[model samples]
Target: MQDQPLDASDFELIEDTLLKYGDDHSVLNASELDGYFTALVSSPVQVDIAEWFPAIWGGQNPDWQSPDEGKQFIELSVRHINALATQLAMHAQAFKPRFEQTEHHAQPLTLAEEWCFGYLRGVAVGNWPELPTPLAAQLQAIAFCAEQDNFEPPADLDVAQHRQQIEAIEAAAHALHDHWVAQR
Candidate 1:
């Protein structure tokens, strides 16, 4: 799909999750909530990866082979993040025309983009192949935030609350993707 997708209730869950955690200091304190948080933060991505993957570069992070190794890792991560941001923007912008639905619709995400991101999440993490670790990790966050659900929205949920929840999740996914782009 070319746009974001979601049922009413899926939106509610996402929003609640975000609203639950958005204000949490931990969410903003760290670049990521998963792997590489501790290890990579202290070292460059390449050095960290090589150190972690001894066969690749032979204990590089601890005793680097070159003075430029750390810089190289930073540059590489930056490139990767930049590229991911462009790709994300392409997909997100691709939704604007389609998701607007009404001339005055505000910050709406389309069903297509949601499906695209969800599908992307599956491909990135679902044992399809060995993909880049950082990208996969970030996609997991997006999936967690924007994930669609099959259940119905609760009976007690008001329409405005549902819409706000959807917007919140969509915003979170977008922000997390932006964080990925910004991290390196």
Candidate 2:
């Protein structure tokens, strides 16, 4: 599948879709954004990761067989997703509309980018029983940013590389968000 060339139409369609999913707010906050993600990802699809048994992969998902193991594994997954979303939402394409439409200096994120990130973060916070609405939303937003930048799921992703990419996006977003926040 990888060896096959990407069709132009397929690529273009995904790219267009990514453009539509950027932040609704010109200047978004983490908590609020996390809430947004939680709302989106709190559906049944997210609840049934690997058929509600993430350990199905020969215990590849952190050996989470026991109740406590499952709980911890889920929590860690959620946190990582939130981080990915945050990175996804921070790209230049996501903030382009904001920059052009408003006075903010932020960049733009495309539809596919926003969708991927939002989806990740949304899924992340959706499973957290203890996650406050605000904190969950913020984390979700962070996840959104990360996902947009090509975040892969744990079982399917390259952990070390993905983490580095997510971290870099987060650092850049933090700087940009801080600057805009200070203006208010």
lDDT of each: 0.35, 0.37
Model 1 clash tally, residue pairs: 10
TM-scores for candidates 1 onward, in order: 0.29, 0.22
Residue lDDT tens for model 1, 55-150: 112223225445565454334334433333344556654221111121113433223233333333323222234336765564554455335423
Over 48-130, each residue of candidate 2 has an lDDT whose tens digit, in order, gives: 45532232222233432367645643454355334433434344233211110111124221222333343344444344344
- Against the true structure, whose TM-score is highest? 1
Q: Model 2, stretches more than 4 Å misplaced? A: 1-156
TM-score of 2: 0.22
Q: In model 1, which regions exceed 4 Å deviation? A: 1-87, 90-148
- Candidate achieving the largest lDDT: 2
On a 0 to 100 scale, what is the lDDT of residue 69 in model 2?
45
Q: List the residue pairs that clash in candidate 1.
A: 3-112, 3-113, 3-114, 4-110, 4-111, 4-112, 4-113, 4-114, 5-111, 5-114
Worst 10-residue lDDT window, candidate 1: 27-36
